[model samples]
Target: MLSLLATLWLAAAPTKDAEPPVPRPPPPECLSSQGRTVCGYQCRSTGTHADCARTPYGVCQVLTGRVHCWDPPRVVIHHPPRSSARPECKESRGNVACGYNCRLSQGEVACNSTPYGVCSTHFGRLVCWDPPESVIHQYGARTPQPRCLNASEAVACGYDCKAQRAEVQCASTPDGVCRLDNQRFTCFDPPSLLHCDHSAPPPAD
Candidate 1:
């Protein structure tokens, strides 16, 4: 009787296979960016976009209209500029003007090397804006001005035909704008400058 009772007790005990573990959503700490406080089960930024996080649960979302999330925690969602293969400016409308023509849709724009005052496409070609006209129109009439500090600055600074890396660092100055790019830096009124290199490598000294 004693041996039989012991056997029955062993049979009643739980085994690993008898109960399956429940899958928990990723931990709050697992869903945050480095050095960021975990917001509910996710990580977020109060200023600019949060740097990419290593947590497997970290996700990036974009949309047409603003959205808020309450499940897990309260969060805001917004849209990002779509990627493009060509040179074009992001318009207020969620579309891109490709090669002097624009179509209102979510996608990339095809670009060419042509300089117009507003980085506009003319006919079916891309052109880089020449100085003065490039400076006056590309920025704005009252928005201060830009000056070239070097040959590279003069030629490489402006709306990049490819949004390439050249580096035109512009800062708001009392007179206008201060800028440094294409290996040069200059100060001007309103203190802004156009700097990008279509052929240069990514941002790094």
Candidate 2:
């Protein structure tokens, strides 16, 4: 009709101002199960909600903060603080004595009824005294002191109240007790400054 109204007035004349599609900031609402998105808020996956975050272009965010650490809520434990200290009694005793009692020379091994005591000083060093004093006393290589005795016969009388020593020097088998400064005289066989012979025999092959 007049060229169709000049092609509809040049297609309604208005083709050079393009720029009206800016609506894409709506994908970050209430998410917190660690999918992230709830900062300025913008989640709309149609709203089924559960910490959403599906964005690859389809968008469905909701997380916030540290990406909003996932689905937690069930923990209540608290118990750690117990120790007042107090539990002794492992069979202790003290008041011991005698570190020597040769019996006469070394004669007393009948069947060993408990009288060969030797807590130290090296050699057979016996230790047997419990009941009405089954007797076998002579153990004092010296090394006691911890204290707390009621009398297991002062631990069979070798005197080791933990052994800090304030008195324990009672001896008398063939007679032998004095070392707290009696100078020196431990009795019996003792007298070999140096002697060795091994029966002689060995000159190489």
Candidate 3:
């Protein structure tokens, strides 16, 4: 009877309590609309609360709580300046000439045309001439005067001629040989006697 009483007391004792189960989070949802698909949403705080949606190409931002998707901004390109449009020019003799054209301004003469000859300024004036005319135009006043010696037997002139008593002659052909023939002093050539006397005759007899 005492053993039976002990068994009843053991059965009456309370059992231990079971622990509670842990809570689980939900899976991410992939939403699809029209032809585009968005995976998840992102939040941005710039002094104000805004939300962004992630897409395959770019992102969609919410302005004033309004959602809008957009592509990246376009890139801009710039080009440098060109140098072939204008030509080089120069100024001279109070004249302005460029390329093949020349003009005068304010009492100044400019020449660029060279179809006849080379363009140049002479005595403050623009002139174009051939080889002979250019030489005369350039050194006409600077050239030395020629003196001729005349006598009964012979006559001589130019830098190479020498006068001795009654006869005057030139030593070398290059010195311009002048001979008094038939009362006329005929020079072979003034500077050089290698060529024929094609030059104009002297003024004095």
Candidate 4:
């Protein structure tokens, strides 16, 4: 029967399996800086913190501040600002401070370092949160005003904290505002600067 109908037409011929695709991951990996602009995939930035994780439980997220991680868990790599550490400056006019015990009155300027680098300031700007232990904070969106910059242990001698990425939202209690850790945003207290809306998608309410 013509070789039994050519073995049933090669077993009813309908086999097309030679698959070898499914590999296209090489885009996202951006890193702007202070102002903000973040992509994804194994990225890295340290103006304060920006890591796009590449494994090791990767999965980071910082909306307003701008940062996008993927897959697994988290990532944080921020160095610098450790020359034995200790900066407690005050007196502002747009001086801007970091860490230590920096504080300016009326105009606002708070300080703190590590143990959750909590800093604060209001009306004029300046905000920070649980940075330093997997840093984050320095968020953007409406983040402007950053003329005089100094660092050491968290301080806003002048301004430009704007919640950044640390995300404390005050309430840790210096008065616990920003909550937990070391707490210290002196200058008469009240007004830790953490309103809302800066950028990305989750800055609405």
Candidate 5:
């Protein structure tokens, strides 16, 4: 009976529950060429294999053997044409004059209005000038002006002027005037002398 009791006691004793073994993570796979290690489902080298990262908008796939991040879908926007008043244009003397706002002269488009002043292609985009005065005054009498300069003198009335050691160089134009390099005096009409002292200083104020 004691033996039977001992067996019963052994059976009745409470058994401690055995703890479950912790899961071991798999070893990381190293990509020798890219020098990166990846584990599980992450990007791993399959020898020139391409992979992609998924996102809500789009998937970014590997390009040129490089891993790219998630990318969104591209959106294209269309713009309407710019609106402006139709230019009043006319052809005259092989040039197209487009109202007072712009003109097409010598195969170039020129606009005249700007915040600072009027603009013309002849002066380039950087050059601007005040608008011409609307009023005109007539003088009682006009005088004939000369166009030539003295020897060895430089004058730049309309264009560039340079004076060398023995000669004076002036730009030739039909409506050009003569003014010394010093800018002391301006000859609206051409001067009689084409040569003058280019080195002369400005006259007294």
Candidate 6:
């Protein structure tokens, strides 16, 4: 048989992972609804007694004839402050522009549209460039940049290379070179440079 003092001591003993008891508010007045008397905070009333948790996910119950309540630790919430700076704007002749680093000059509005881009008016058209990008003009698009071939030594680059035994010749245009007679190592460019034999086999009828 356990003594009353031993029982009290056992009840007061701190167990492993024991949660701290929550302080409950006094029993609120019972409310009679649907022929039933509901008591305690949020229906946690136990036989003329009441117990409830103050924090989130808290619970209360009767254990060993005593109202016990436990609650998770209180949590604090932090929020970032709102920004007060307004958006940049530029207005011209009833027209409005909104963005960063806005500009209104010569009846035109320009903004720093792209990252690291400096916007400007080119021929009355707003143009932005920084990390370079391709821009095709409406009229007279820029001719593609010539891709010239480079070599350490002489690089004969063309489709007009004509070889004749000990002689090598080439023409400027692709369909320019006709025949490289096994005679002269001549490189022709159009206006009929070297005189050749005018004689030819008669056309067969």
Model 4's TM-score against the true structure: 0.21
Highest TM-score against the true fold, candidate? 4
62-105: candidate 1 lDDT, tens digit per residue: 22232112221011011101222222233334533322122232
lDDT of 5 by residue, 62-101 (tens): 3334443332211100110122322233343443332224
Candidate 6, 166: how far from true, in Å? Answer: 45
What is the full ranking by lDDT, best candidate first? 4, 6, 3, 5, 1, 2
lDDT of the candidates, in the order given: 0.31, 0.27, 0.35, 0.40, 0.32, 0.38
lDDT measured at residue 161 in model 1 versus the true structure, 0 to 100: 19
Evaluated at residue 17, the lDDT of candidate 4 is 90
Give per-residue CA lDDT, model 4, range 1-205, as digits (tens): 9999999999999999988555444455677777776666556565666766553223454433444444311212122232333333343555444334445667666555432244455444665443322112333211222223233433332223223233322222232223233543322234436443322211100
TM-score of each: 0.19, 0.13, 0.18, 0.21, 0.21, 0.21
Instruction: Evaluate residue 98 in candidate 1 and report its C-alpha lDDT on the 0 to 100 scale.
Output: 27
Per-residue CA lDDT of model 2 for 1-205, tens digit only, reads 9999999999999989887654443444454434534432223332333433232112122322212112101110011012221111111122122111212113222111122323221133333322112111122111122112222233323332222233232333322233433433232222223333233222111
Clashing pairs in 6: none
| lDDT tens digits by residue: candidate 6, 1-205 | 4698899999999989977565443444444444556444433554555554443233455544444544322110011012221224455665555433456777776544222223544344554322212211111112121111222322232235555443444444333453556565456444423332322221111
Q: Which ten residues in a row have the lowest lDDT in candidate 5?
A: 132-141
Q: After superposition, how far is residue 34 of candidate 2 from its true place, in Å?
A: 67
Among all windows of 10 consecutive residues in model 1, the one with the lowest summed lDDT is 72-81
Per-model C-alpha RMSD: 22.1, 38.0, 43.6, 18.0, 33.5, 36.7
2 against 6, candidate with superior TM-score: 6
